[model samples]
Target: SLRINKGMHVDGNWPALGAAAAVAHSLGLTPAQTAQAVQIAACQLPMSLYLPVRSGDTSRNTYLGHSAQLGQSAALAVASGITSPGNAVREYAHVVLSKEPEPFDDTHGFHLLQAYVKPYAAVRHVHYGAWAACMLRPALDPDKIEHVILDVYEEAVIYCGNRAPQTPLQAQFSLSFGLAAMLGWGRLDPWVYREPQFQDAMLRALEAKVQVQVDASWTQQQMRGARLRIECSDGSRYEQEITAVPGDAQMPFTERELVDKFLGYCEASMPLDSARLWARQLLVAPTNTHPFPFWNLPQEKTPC
Candidate 1:
């Protein structure tokens, strides 16, 4: 199967495309079947296209995850002899890409790998906000920070305009809340979007300090890029511009890092040793194995 953006392209859309192609190939589908699967996956999981277009949202972080799952499902459907309209991509182009009512991309060389990944979990537009928070942390005494003035791309303001969020989930999509979370917690994690922290007085105070603005020069082409200008209580100012968020393929995660993340996520639900062993075996398991032993391991419920 051809993976358009399997290698070095800055576009964030590549992950979904690559994932769909990978799933189709793994399921032993034909080229046409795989392409159809990819189109279906893209349509079913429009987060890549929609998430970025919208202001910062928590769902944006999981867009690729949705694509991956949908791709797997689409491939399975094809393997099960389910018929699709065969014009998945054409339909997508008509409904999604083109303003017109018809799909028109016949070009084979077009690839999606041009996409990038956010190093932090917050919205792609606010990576620099997080970075600015970190940079300002050392310069200003947290107790004395009176206010923060954030000057970012106009699109940033447009995307993350929700200033006051009543819930952590909402806060995850709010620029002010994200900057506040980063400042108070020093990191952005799944828990940062949980209850008490979302309601924390200190975090709320920090959130109150953050202000956003837009820059006319910042264009849609610069999706993951941001510029942060911070004004502090002590009359100190700090400014930084991030061209690309970390964890992009250019700044790829190491294999060990990937393994550690996988272990961290799965170890709590299963015995750590068992999980590790199962993972290791699965990594090297031969194709001839009809029933994978990993699936037969004791199943346990994990916290969602």
Candidate 2:
């Protein structure tokens, strides 16, 4: 019952929501009930609305969190004889895709596939900047990196280039900060999101090197494109251009890599063995199981 589009990145809590909905549907829950469960699941998800977006914040990020909880809630409501819009997902999809008028097509091919995932847990726009920063690392010593020129799609600058980041959370949304971390550390990882890293002198100097330029030809269809150029004090120059960031379906992570990432994020919170066991089960389980003991673990111990 757990149906997923091929080549999609099931990041954040999306996999959990999909599994819960499939299990509910398989247990004879009506479509309306299933829809209610999904809504409830989405409502319970944690929200991160502070991430900036072009012109204004789009509800895409917040909606996904809500959609997960909503799915669960819809499923439970149906099981308990509650009623909801029979075409819940259809309607919701219409809203997100900017469909006009009532009676939207359920088969209209909503382009959820266009959504991208973050390989580095930072703002989506910052991914290319991070990629660029990492590429320049070997050529330029952190102390010698004099400046960075970030040539990105116009939308990226507007959304991710706000005032200087004053908090770790804010830094995640800053192109300059992300690039600085990449230049100074030779990579961007969860550890780079810490307070000390955010306040480092070398990072600030690298941040000063960051600059943005708008690419007029870019379009929504070309969301993943970015270009970076770096200059070092010893007359060394490094540059890289990526049409699409890594972790997209075109450049998917290997199964082992994905599993490693999942486990790495969960091990500290959950029993490492249990998390590994459940992740294996999820990959090949014939049918979705009941709330396995694995699913009932304490919230702090749950695998992301």
Candidate 3:
């Protein structure tokens, strides 16, 4: 998604910081040193605006490579005691932003999330792109569909429509591909980007028929909306307009949902019981408790 939709390389920040901190911890750096290391790494961070999507190969590893390396480099630099945190961040910022020329795009996935998708995600259990996919599905007939037309605000068109998406990351950033994927598979799942599914003949046909246009009337900043119009081969027409998405400050994810997501991440590696135990300890543990019992949780033994 960072490849095309949003030019800002924010996805790299957390991983780089995490790597820096972990290295600092291993080196037994003082709090000040650790902070300085993180600062230095952040300053040295580079954004990869030029996506290799046009060249194919959209693996997660490829997208995260630069950020991950920079993060570890920061940690290593701090461990070596040669980097001055304050000056490093300042100088790096000047060098990256001022000394170099970079292309800037006005629309980004972050803005779409903050302004539109999150609200819908919070309310409908789907992001705006996914919601558009779902809403467009019923209008299309698997056997007789002619084309799909999506009319949305300018930023939506700018951020979501990618004509040449070669990788899953590019696919996710594409409004047309995402919607087509949802329609082709009846729903979008992480696995939808894998194997035969990525090369699914039916989805490619559907995606080829998607066209997105900007609605000139939605010129205001707060106008976050989209209209999906379908034209069938039988000369029939269907339209759906979404003026508001859910999950804004007005609508929120329930506490149970948050807990479910947290547990899902934990259970991906360990047993559910272990995840639950750790979660209980992490949530209820008193502030500044030493030894951090949650971190001491036993590793899962591999089944031979």
> Against the hidden true structure, what lDDT does model 1 obtain?
0.62
Best of the two (2, 3) by lDDT: 2
Candidate 3 per-residue lDDT over residues 85-137, each given as its tens digit: 46554454455555432333556455434542242111122245456657667
Q: Rank the candidates by lDDT, best first.
A: 2, 1, 3
Looking at model 1, residue 264 earns an lDDT score of 57
Segments of candidate 3 deviating more than 4 angstroms: 1-35, 47-49, 58-69, 72-94, 98-126, 136-144, 152-161, 164-167, 214-225, 233-236, 241-251, 254-304
**Residue-level lDDT tens digits of model 1 in 131-201:** 66776666656566666766667656655666777755455557787787777877775667667776889
Give lDDT: candidate 2, residue 118: 61
Q: What C-alpha lDDT values do all the predictions have? A: 0.62, 0.64, 0.61
Candidate 1's displacement at residue 12, Å, is 16
Cα shift from native, residue 74, model 1 (Å): 4.8
Q: Rate residue 212 of model 1 by lDDT.
A: 72
Specify the highest-lDDT model's number: 2
